[model samples]
Target: MPDATFKIFRGDRDGGELYEYKVPIAPGMVVLDALHYIQAHDAPDLAVRWNCKAGKCGSCSAEVNGRPRLTCKTRLDALPLDQPITVQPMKSFPVLKDLVTDVSWNYRVNKKIPPFTPRPNVEWKMDQREVDRVQEFRKCIECFLCQNVCHVLRDHEKQEQFGGPRFFVRIAGLEMHPLDGLSRTELLKEELGIGLCNITKCCTEVCPEDIHITDNAIIPLKERVVDDFYDPVRWFLRKLSGKKH
Candidate 1:
């Protein structure tokens, strides 16, 4: 019934500022709907990345009211309409344009993880219960909101050293799969820098898929890293035998 104000970020990698716009709110209107209105009525040149628009593709991610969210799923009525609704590109990555970010870093990090290699001569079939735990990780749509919220990537800027939560979830799926033959513990420790994560659980809070990034993926991976490198008994055995247990 009333026009809601939107403070949308506009600019490129060098820098940018929020530009305010007013759009007519409709019943059950989502933030993406408002953005489409702006693009059609106000700023035809505005850039936004989206696909599916059903929250399944995870492409319409942005910071709404300073929180990482999928704009397509964020309802206009849920926000405080009295003031300008702030929407900006994710801060963890470089901005390509208004409301669009350079998420290519995530791709680069993903390439380093070893792909799932099933055990040789293993039966193709397994009980559903065996895969039930790993299936939880498959729900991830690669939104990277988890990555944007991770302190290791957001505040500390540890991109070179850390794989972020998204990759860890992927690694968890691969590591826990019943037939998977590869071990990623060393990769998690040496390359991904799993130890850098202090288990803040900020990533889990923003996840739209409800994937337990901290508890299920990250913590388990962290435990494997500890067991391999930090266990005092194991370290002593390795030192005495000069062989890994």
Candidate 2:
């Protein structure tokens, strides 16, 4: 409708500065479109990580209007485009130059998850009813938007201790397996630091797939961890049985 000014943060692990750019507005342009136009015409050096601009790939995640959102999916018309649009790299990760944050940390954390080691020689055949539970986890596109919005990692900078919400979905898919039974609650509690999440649901708010990241995934795992370690009745039963589950 009118001219739009973008105050974009530009820089990296070493150092950088915020640069402003003006671009003519169109009827139905998204934020990603504007960034691409700027990169093509004005700022050729703009380093942004975006692929599958249809919002399937989660690479182009950044803070739009100070909220962690996928740029490709956010429409400019949805915002107050009459003013300067502030676009910045996700604060949770190291800036890699202009709107692109180093998300390699997510891949590193993903490696720590134990693989689904199914039982020995057990012919695994799951009914749709049983398979339906884990299918919800399939909706996740590995967009680290949830990871960035999580205050434990974003604000408090607890990546060394807390794994963030993305892994909760990861752990949930594995831990909830009907046949593949492994006690990761201990690993989640001690090694991975699941206790750091305070159920703020910030992760849920930014999820593009609308997966119940807190209620369905993280909270259930937390309850399981509590039942395993903290429940007095379960502790007594385990002691009497002389067995650990």
Q: Pick the candidate with the highest lDDT.
A: 1
Q: Per-residue alpha-carbon lDDT of model 2 for 113-140, expressed as tens digits?
A: 8888787776778878878998888789
**Each model's backbone clash number:** 0, 0
Local error of candidate 2 at 148, Å? 0.8
Over 134-230, each residue of candidate 1 has an lDDT whose tens digit, in order, gives: 9999999988999999989999999999999999999999998999888899999999999999998999999999998999999998988887799
Error of 2 at 3 (Å): 2.1
List RMSD in Å for every model shown.
Answer: 1.4, 1.3
Strongest candidate by TM-score: 1
